[model samples]
Target: MQPGTFELLILIFIFLGLQAWWIIPIINKNNKFNKRGKDLREEIKQLEKLYKK
Candidate 1:
């Protein structure tokens, strides 16, 4: 016999779950790095403002 709709859906769900499990952490790490970079830029801007005053 062949696979049915439910099996197909389960397989798709598992595949997406695995993909997300691997990808989400990388995405989160990149986001954290981006936030840190943004914070550093803001601090530099503040320092420049203070220096010019």
Candidate 2:
């Protein structure tokens, strides 16, 4: 059976919603990882300065 235009639009929205649900968490995780990496780099720089003294 062929889908009507309204049914097609609904299907498209559902697909887009599912894609966003899967993608949003991954984006959030990457941001957190990037922030942690920056923090660690700063800590390392401080440690290196202490060692130089």
Candidate 3:
């Protein structure tokens, strides 16, 4: 209800929004790499299974 507190809340939201804008793309890129890593691990496991058999 206080004007100063409201302004502070708005500033915090703006800061967090900006941070998310910058961070989300990096997180998405990392996710892509993580998915690729998982796929590679699966392939490796399959290869090992084939070799054992």
Candidate 4:
């Protein structure tokens, strides 16, 4: 059986929403890690400076 226009629209919306829901958290997690990475690098640099001094 062929789907009607309304049914197709609903399916597309659902698929897009589900994709966003799954993808958004991963994007946010990567953003958090990226922010932390800078801090970690700074701390490592400080440690190296202390060791060299």
lDDT of 3 by residue, 1-53 (tens): 76699889989999999999999999999999999999999999999999999
Question: Per-residue lDDT tens digits of candidate 2, residues 1-53?
Answer: 56598899899999999999999999999999999999999999999999999
| Pairs with backbone N, CA or C atoms under 3 Å apart (clashes), candidate 2 | none
After superposing candidate 2 on the true structure, give the runs of residues whose Cα lies further than 4 Å from its correct spot.
1-3
lDDT (Cα, tens digit) per residue for candidate 1, span 1-53: 46598899899999999999999999999999999999999999999999999
Question: TM-scores, in order shown?
Answer: 0.77, 0.88, 0.71, 0.80
Stretches off by above 4 angstroms in model 4 are: 1-3
Give the winner by TM-score. 2
Q: Residue 13 lDDT in model 3?
A: 100
lDDT of 4 by residue, 1-53 (tens): 56598899899999999999999999999999999999999999999999999
- Give the local distance difference test score of model 1: 0.97
lDDT computed for candidate 2: 0.97
Arrange candidates, best TM-score first: 2, 4, 1, 3
For residue 17, model 4's alpha carbon misses the true position, in angstroms, by 0.4
The residue-level lDDT of candidate 1 at 28 comes to 99
